[model samples]
Target chain A: MFIEFKDVSFKYPNNDKNVIDHLSFTLEKGSMLAILGHNGSGKSTIAKLIMGLLKATSGSIYICDTLLDEKSIDDLRQKMSIIFQNPDNQFVGVTVKDDIAFGLENHQIPRQEMLEKISKYATLVDMMAFLDANPENLSGGQKQRVAIAGALAMETELIIFDEATSMLDPKGTKEINAMIKKLKNEHNKTIITITHNLEEALFADRVMVINDGKIVLDGSPQEVLKEQTILEASGLKLIDGIAIIKEIEKTSLLSKENKEKICEALWELTFKM
Target chain B: MGINFQNVDFKYAKKASHKQLDNVSLNIDEKDEFIAIVGHTGSGKSTLVQHMNALLFANSGNITIFDTKVVRNKKIKLKPIRKHVGLVFQFPEYQVFETTVLDDIMFGPKNFGKTTDLAKELAIKASQLVGLDEELLTRSPFTLSGGQMRKVAIAGALAIDPDILILDEPTVGLDPKGKIELMELLLAMQNKTHKSIIIISHDMNIVAKYTKRIMVMHSGKLVFDGSKEALFNNEALLKEYNLDLPTAAYLAKELKAMHLIDYDSLPLTKEELTHIILGDSCNE
Candidate 1:
């Protein structure tokens, strides 16, 4: 496994109940995993645990076959990066170019190599034109792209997005979603997207619904998102695409077996229209 | 008279070059209207709505909400206009501060000089309007769930009894079910009170289903303003504004193109789509 967690549990110092209770999961290399849950369901806690910001009360974590603990903390840090919800809070440099180069500078990459990597990643996010622009002057979507460029430049094995799309408008959200798909298909980057948006979950290779500090459902997006009961229990609903299909199924025309194929056709139709 | 804007232009600061609202003009009726403002972020939707309550004075043109007129270098008492136009900011939880949910909700009415007893009466009525349980009134607002916190903030706005209510991205971070519940509550409020409700939303489906009128903004200008059907049918304008078509309309259009469904017009709701697919009578 590229990353593994076994019976991990955690509790805040002031609270008696554990926010994460005996949670267990594993991720393979270059896989896209989406973590979904209602508010206060310990979704963000799992991301913090995997990033080593919070220690597990019990059980173990392994990264690339190395046990995760204080002894190997620094080594584990080099293997992963996290992008938080608010892009403004995560920005550290004045300009887009400086921000992307800041991460490489900390890793002690040579000056010549750093510039090449910065330009390469910036172009990947389509932000090469704004390299010298002030980060504050950019739009919400542009700022997020710059953040992703910085993360990609680090060349980490895994990246965790913590509700990164929650604050964006629909257009901005769609752009970021496309970027994630490209990072998975083209760059072979392992990703863990933590979000409450079920539509985003539909884009992932695997979806896990966490509730009450435990994963209540886990499967591919096609399977897990189809379970209406589980989705309602987790304070979620079917995305509009699937919901429209289900509505069609309730009518007399479409059979259950043809639902999936027809739904895909409808999506393709929507795009062409 | 209703709200009117004429060639409004606004900038955030004196040194800022980009105009947040440039040559903007629109008119909103005082009652019997549910309007949706759709746009990409920083497209001047917020800037335009803020002018309704005089929170932002126009730098170049004139704005008249009811009888109050606001313009550059003009003296106008904004309190009366604000009393009629209630503006709910995005993430209203940041505005909550009172000890109890009831107190928090009553704060708005009290700020307008209502006596405590009268404010409490208004708060109770607003809570009922939003379907908040009476049992939770005494609890601290901070102890409630995110959805409940949002309801409390909305209730605070309702307690003011404004003639017009405007919300900016009210459902940004909520789950799907929570979003529906909030929208339903807003709809019920509009129906019962006959207040003109304006919402700034990015969700095209919600806009198609809820509002009769749509105002599309791009580059700090009102690019399109008409019925939802007109807005969806204008493919070139939608593309230029970078807006996504509503799910049902887009699906219907595609199905028509594929020759899969024989409907002449696009469906704007799931029921309409289902009817066209099944070739059944419009039972719904």
Candidate 2:
């Protein structure tokens, strides 16, 4: 496993209860995982813990087969990058080109290599045209694309998006989703997306639900989302395609075989459209 | 009576070439109105709503809110107009700065020149209206949950007793259930007060389920304004405005394409779509 958590638990200094309660999970290299949960469900906490922003109260975490401790923290951090919910808060440079270069320069990359990497990742995110544009002048979608370019320019193996699309409109959300797809399939980057938007999770290789700091449901996206009652209990709803199919199943008007065929077709059409 | 806008045009600065609001005109009643303004990002939805409260004056044309007229280069008392039209910004919870919830709720009333005692009375009433627990009113607003903090911020707006209440992207970061609960709370508030309620949203599902009137803006232009049914039914208008259908309507259309279900009208909610599909099979 590229990332592993074993019986990890965390509690804030002032809070009595654990925010993450003995949670255990693993992700293989070059796979996309979607973490779904409601407000205060510990989904964001897991991301922080993995990124070494917060120390785990108990248990162990391993990154690239090395234990995550204070001694190895700096080494592990170099292999990961995180894009937060607000694009404005994360920007450190005045221009898009400077922002992407900020991360590359911190790692002490030579000036020539930094420029090449910046242009390459900027073009990959479709932001090459806006490289000279000021971050303040760009739209929310454009700002997020610049953020993605910065993250990719670091060339980290693992990237985490923490509710990155919740602040955007549909157009912006769609743009980020396209980038996520490309990063997973073409670039083979390990991805973890923490979001409440169930529709965005439909394309994930694996989906997990967190309820009260515990992983209550985990499996393939289709398998995990099929548990309608469980999902609702965890403050989630099925995606529109699976939801329609479930409603169809309740009415006995269609045969079992026909229902199965319709389900497959509907699922395919959902993503295609 | 109500608020009226005539040929309103606004630009951010004198040198900026593009107008943020271009030749806009509309009317919103003082009572019993539920409307949503939607468009792509940077399409001027926020700029349009800011004008409702005199936060941004028009560079050209005029706005009549109740009886006060807002025109360029005219000096008038803007406080009364702002008092009658309350605007809650996006991520309102971030604006909560008072130590206690009650103090936060009372800020608006006090700012409008109400005495402390009267402000307290109105604050308590508004807190009750938003369904916030009385016990939580004394607790620090920082300690409350995200949803509760949002309710407290809304109560602050309600305490001012504006005839028209507007919210910008009120459910942006909330969960699915949280979104539904907040929308329902706003609906109940509208029913109880009979005041106009306008929200700026990007989620078509919320617009279709809760709001009656839908306004679409494109490049700072008011392209369409009418009922949800009319807006969703017009494919060319929706495409031109850069709007997408509600999930239920999209599902119904896809099912029709696969020759599974046919409907005379698109369903805006899952319940409506299920009813149409089941009703069709039963008739067959």
Chain B structural similarity (TM-score) per candidate: 0.95, 0.97
lDDT by residue for model 1 (A1-273), tens:
889999999999888898999988999999999999987889999999888999998989988889999999899989899988889898999999999998999989999999999999999999999999999999888899999999999999899999998888887787798899899999999999999877788778999999889899999977886787778788876665566666765765565545555667765543333
Best by lDDT: 2
Please identify model 1 stretches exceeding 4 Å from their true place: A13-18, A108-110, A253-264, A267-273, B12-18, B72-75, B279-284
lDDT of 2 by residue, B133-160 (tens): 9999999999998888889998999999
Error of 1 at A11 (Å): 3.8
Candidate 2 structure quality by residue, lDDT tens digits, A37-148: 9999999999999999999999999999999999999999999999999999989998999999999889899999999999999999999998888999988888899999
Estimate candidate 2's alpha-carbon lDDT, on a 0 to 1 scale: 0.90
Q: How much is B263 displaced in model 2, in angstroms?
A: 1.5
What is the fnat value (0 to 1) for candidate 1? Answer: 0.58
DockQ (C-alpha based) per candidate is: 0.48, 0.64
Model 2's chain A TM-score stands at 0.95
